[model samples]
Target: MAAPPTDSFTEFQTNLTQTKAQSTTTNGNTVSRGPSPNRGASVPDNEAIGPESTTQQKWLTEHGIDKSKWVKLKRLNHMRYQHEDLNVITTFLKDFGVKVVKKTETERWYAGYGPDQYVYYARQGPRKFLGGVFEVDSREDLEKLVRDHADTLQTKGIEEMTTAPGGGSIVTILDPEGFPVNFVHGQSQRAPQQMPEKLVVNDESTKPRARQFQRFSPGPAAVHKLGHFGLVSAKFDVLREWYTTHFNIVPSDMLYIDLPNGGRKEVAMFAHLDLGQDLVDHHSLFLATLTPDSSIPEPHVHHCSFEVHDFDTQALGHQWLAEKGYQNVWGVGRHILGSQIFDYWWDTSKFMVEHYADGDLVNEDTAVGYGPAGHEGLAVWGPDVPQEFLH
Candidate 1:
């Protein structure tokens, strides 16, 4: 059986603050405090959400997480929000990588990420967590993404222009479902410099392994540009269709869950899809299953993953985690699909945070075809998942 609720919602919030203080010295940059606790009760969007006053750190701690483990709190690395329609949501996300090819405000905007990309989006009445945005390498990248994805850019109307902290320009648009979308460019107007030393990549092996394959050419660039997202939805089919049609995301594989006979006979294991980029291995997004009878309204991301330069960064994270006394859920396991070494830990909010290296890159000529369903699909090369880590 699922774990029963322990503390009241208010007590949960209090515990969160106290736990974070015990975790780390690095207090992440505070953004607009996100919506208050769900209060185990559904509420309207316009209605003041719980209390806007709470900090993300406090909220995260409430759920048994530590905030300092995250490497990029000061600069938002990624975001995920929700919208009513898939077309509208896809339109905004595509701005990050590919430009819209042909958009008719009447036609749904479904283009985003790349061919093998996977993204998570959820819908619940008028509220949603569409998707999170990541910090980019440069201003040229911002311009380039807009140019490439311009063909797919579709929006009903956009307003609420503002400036980001570093002078980055910000714009907000509504997806087909009425979710808010935000994009920023030319912030700080500075040249992309070396990412922090802690963020550097390291792979010293000169001899190539017989079984290991590197499909992509090496440079400062990586094949999989961004991270992963997990979206939740009651209508998984609708959200899944929207993602596949517009984003060009292919279904690499899916996971199904067998509920205790009282419920549906079988639901998917997490649905795994891939953004067809030879530059990176694994799907850019993974959608966990949700049924209509559940209390949550929409299917959305379970969590997101960031690409560290190499295994050295992963080592740094592991050491840091041990030094700080935070929990490690899984990994140092290598995934067969992406060929990336993995490590999983809980953040201040207890969301899974993945730090990885050496992911597989997929392109036209050398793509690996999708495989059949089963436990093998999730980790072509890792240990079986422990029960406590499944959630």
Candidate 2:
């Protein structure tokens, strides 16, 4: 069967003709459009995110993670979100730079310019997250996942992905916290959609361009594909073990807080696929402990991040979303861990989505690094980290 006509090329360039607009302020809080006043009151710079958020400095140390078993995953495939209204989210998805792959009254799937058939999947109803999906290395791996977790609640058995845009097979497992994680083996692949070529830069040390003048047309920083996402789990230790031991994910970096009297507690981690000798993104998934001070009652996803071209594209994309009146959650900053220049926003459903650029990559040979937990480790520079964004 043929893939749905997503109008990938044409739709990516949509809204380019619309005149750029600025954000309007309501009461006093400046809602995320371009530049605004000093954000009213003085917000603290890089404050820790929990109750007495620091542990003893000595607790910061490196540790080895055991990767005993493996269910090989080729890469992250896509993410799913259940929205209150498909129409509203569809509108936001376009602004977020994912082209429509297929749409129905109750379901819609989106595609990025990347080879992955679809980058995001949405369902209509009360807002909910369906979890990120991964493409397993082989059908045998999918079989292993089902067989290994057969008796556990994680098992739902393998089934054909009939309704999906690109027909394939999928198996979704519920992790320790009941977060749904889907695994796929077979899916049709498509040629990546055409994108603007990379721009050349002339640094102080060297000048590359001699005569060509640089210019750009404002538009959404069209997405390349999904980058990475994070979760704050009440049962952090269990989930971390379950993921790394069961699947081929290993930590690249670990964040811990020192205890008052003795022990050290790891609060967050950045993990990558354990593809030996082959380099992959510094982190394909992130996990963090739910600090006792956080108001959120249960374990849940933090945000889903997507990859855009570079700084200029991300900036324009930020401008486009802010101009559209979407609330900025946090970002337009460089993170200390993965080194991604990130921009985050609250989607129509109030879930956070991110646009990121220039992330680091690692492989099995890269030794995991450890650090102390604090807001300073979050970003190297950008707008002040919003309090709402922490945790």
Query: Which candidate achieves the best lDDT against the true structure?
Result: 2
Q: Give the lDDT of residue 49 in candidate 2.
A: 22
Worst 10 residues of 2 by lDDT: 39-48
Tens-digit lDDT track for model 2 on 43-85? 1211212232222111122223444557888899899889998
RMSD per model, one decimal: 22.2, 14.4
Candidate maximizing TM-score: 2
Q: Candidate 1, residues 1-391: lDDT per residue as tens digits?
A: 1224543555555665554344323368444433344333222211212332233233234434332222111122334433455464443333222233333433222212222122222232343344554333445444444554454443322222232223344333432333333444444422332442333223566554555553432212121234665555455555554444333243433444445675432233222232223333445555545654444455434555656656654565566565556666776677644456777765433445566676654432232233333445556455676543444
Give the residue spans of candidate 2 off by over 4 A. Answer: 1-68, 152-156
TM-score of each: 0.46, 0.82
